[model samples]
Target: MCISNPNSISDQTDLVAMKARLWALLRKEEHEWLQKSRLKWFKEGDINMKFFHLTASSRAKRNQISKLKEIPVKRLSVGSRRLLERLFSEEEVWNMSCRLCLIEDSSFNNSFISLIPKIDEAVSPEDYRPLSLVGSLNKIVSRVMARRMASCLKEVVGENQFAFIVGKQIVDCVLIANEVIDDLSKKKKKL
Candidate 1:
């Protein structure tokens, strides 16, 4: 009763076109959903969405397969080195305070030199947070003290030898060792 239609090529082409249109619509919807999901995820935390997306797909993986791929790098200069040193020293002093509290009250002589690297590792980039106003002020004071100490070192020794001394690196030490005594004295008004 039914005969085979040899002119079914047009009908097959229509079906293929419909399928392609449906696939495009579905892909658009999926992309919108992904963008919304990524926005929500980033809003929940400090996750960098761009980094997440770049590392999410296989296409990105293939692009990164080459060793010559562009990689961002920041070279640390003398100022940055000094800042890092000060941060490390301050963290060390804080940890040492904790150890001192555990031992004798107000004790400064503790055998805890090895704890510096541990503290540094614990306070990684992910754990870093913005400093408060008071903390920033304290850091400024420390830096000024460090600069003064370096100047004093240069006077005692020579400029060439003291040139290697990081201003921020010696700030805490200078402040604690009474090198900033005159500066503090000037701050105290007679009652």
Candidate 2:
């Protein structure tokens, strides 16, 4: 049946009637599919709670950073130093304070704090990653330059090597590669 009641946009009864009819058709199709095949929809069929839980866990584990290369935050503040005084030895405090000092130094231009997900069951120290943040001013300037240069870039960049070029897709490279392979196959037969 045609699924339109133009007046239903303003009329509640007509809208409800239309929705009931649509639901009836969908349920009818679902019953037919259930009868026709053994396969059931994932959410509506055989529930594998343990398998889904494990798959979700594996995906989360794979995305974690094994180690960090940068040592940007060196030290703890006096308050932090006091707090960590018992937890860390004297030597540890010195190392932490130096990094904290570096983080505070405005003279060290264009550095910002980076925070990312870390692996902990609950919110704790082990649950976050640190990265070097870039300056906002530099980001704005780079974006402006990219926008202005896009038109000029289209003229100079080759028909291939379309990675960063505007209005081109990597799919184009795949298509061109297929054509080259086909030509090579035909040429080999001729020779």
In model 2, the Cα lDDT at residue 18 comes to: 82
Regions more than 4 Å wrong, model 2? 1-110, 115-130, 182-191
Candidate 1, 1-191: lDDT as tens digits: 22256368877677778889999999999999999987877775346767656656756778674657686544555664564455445654555445434334443232222223334456665545444333333444455555545544433443333234655344555556685686567677542
Residues 43-120, candidate 2: write the lDDT tens digits.
Answer: 533497776678678998999888989854334345543443344345644454454444444644476776677764
Q: What TM-score, to 2 decimals, does candidate 1 have?
A: 0.21
Cα RMSD (Å) between model 1 and the true structure? 23.8
Candidate 1, residue 163: the lDDT equals 36
Best by TM-score: 2
Give the number of the best model, judged by lDDT: 2
